[model samples]
Structures are given as C-alpha cells and as structure tokens.
Target: MDINRMQDKIIAEFENLATAVNKFSYFRHLKKISNGSQPMDPEDKNDRNLVTGCSRKVWVTAYKEDGRIFFKADSEHSITRGLVNLLLKVYSGHTVSTITNTDLYFLHEIKLFNYLSASWMRDFLSVIQRIKSLAIVQHLDAAPRS
Candidate 1:
C-alpha cells in the first residue's frame, strides 16, 4: 500500500480503541509483526545503527534495493520492535523521494506520542530521522558522479 493509506490504516486501528487499556491491548498485537521481521545480526547491531536514548537497545539498518529502500531492525523491547516494524512497513519498498518526502502524521494521529513517555517518543522520532538520513545518503550515492 502507499504511505498515506498505510498511515490512515494505522490511525484507524488506533482510533478503533476507545481507552488506554484498549490501545495497549492493540499494541500487544503489533508484536506479531515485530516477530516476523528479520533479526539483526550481531555485526549489524553495532553502534553505528544502534538507536540511542531508548530505554532498550534498538538497532536499525537500511539498504537500497531496486531504487527502493529496505530496512532491518531489532529491539530488546517488544513494543519498540513493533514500532520499528510499523515504520519499516511504511517506508520500505519505496523510493528515496517517497521516503523523504512523505509526511508521517499517523504517528500523532495514532496517539503514539501521547501513549509513550517523552524519552521513548524521542527514540521513535530518532528512528524516523535515521531512516530518512539513510535514504538521503543512498540517494546521493546513487546519483551519477559529475
């Protein structure tokens, strides 16, 4: 699905839940997606990709495939892992322009910012920034050297 649709879907899912308990319940279900993502290898979990400021260790790696970005992430915490999975689902398999240009309002619409503490939310925002930075670097690398 396109990024906007995916964002809408996430918002809808969270909107379906009326209470904090229900939201947490739905978040637990996101673990299934997290479990299905590829695990980060020990070598891939180095400090370069390790997301700092999070309560738990979260590592992310990105590469370009067929002009689209792909991401791999691993986190010690299930909720963080699921958040990574959610981001990968939206940004992966999309071109750099799409990745960098897309507006990520779903994060707020889903109330993730409200649900998570300031530090945890910062970690999540950092993950998004890292993803965009990787996309920018990849885009520059793919450009023809003049």
Candidate 2:
C-alpha cells in the first residue's frame, strides 16, 4: 500500500482505541511484535547507524533495493522502538523521492505529540531526519555523474 493509505490505516487503528492509555498499550504491543520479528543486526548498531539525539539508544539503517528504500531500526526503549516501527511501516519499501517528499500527516492525525515528552519528540524527529538523510544519499548515489 502507499504511504498515505498506510498512515490512514494507522490513524484509524489508533482512533479505535478510545483512551490514551489504550493507544500507549498498542504501541507497546507493536514494540514486542517488532522486536520478535526484526531484531537489528549487531553490526547495524554501530555509530554510523546510531541516532544521536535520542536519550535512549536508537539505531536506524536504510538500504535501497529495486529502487525502493527500506529501513530497519531498533531502540533501547520500548516506546521508542514502537514509534520507529510505526514510521518504518509507513515509510519503508518506498522510493527515495517518495520517502523524502511525503508530509507525515499521521503524526498529527494520531496526536502523538500530545502523548510524548519534548525530548522524546525531538528524538523521534531526529529519527525521521536520519531516514530522509539516508534517502537523499541514496538519491545522490543513484544520480548519474555529470
């Protein structure tokens, strides 16, 4: 599915949870599922992939295959990991241009900022910046040398 549709589906899922606590619980559940299935490789935890702004240790790595970008991420904190997983669900398996250009309306649609601490939000934005930076690098690398 496209990014917007994926984001809308997530918003609908979150909307089904009536309370903030329920939404938070859903994130924890997502974290558990994400960790079980896609544990980050030890090599990917290096400084090169580590996202620096987060108080919790977070690592994000990106690769391009068949002209689509894919992201894999892990975090020391459960909520952070879940949040990253949420972003990965929306942004992964897309072209570099698509990833970079898309406006992340889901963040607002789900009212995520209201639940998270300022520092956590900053960290989350850093994760996004890292993803976009990786996408930009991939675009540049793929460009024909003038």
Of the candidates shown, which would achieve the greatest TM-score relative to the real structure?
A: 2
For every candidate in turn, the CA RMSD to the true structure comes to: 2.2, 2.1
Per residue, candidate 1 scores C-alpha lDDT tens digits across 1-146 of: 88899889877776776655555576776676679787778899888888766667988888887888888888988888998888987898889999999989888787676667787788888888888888888778888897
For model 2, the stretches where C-alpha displacement exceeds 4 angstroms are: 19-37
Lowest summed lDDT across 10 adjacent residues in model 1 is found at: 17-26
Judged by lDDT against the true structure, how good is candidate 1? 0.82
- Whole-model lDDT values for every prediction: 0.82, 0.84
lDDT of 2 by residue, 11-129 (tens): 98777765655655766665664674377898889988998788889999888888898888998787788888889888899998899899999989888887787898899999999
lDDT of 1 at 84: 89
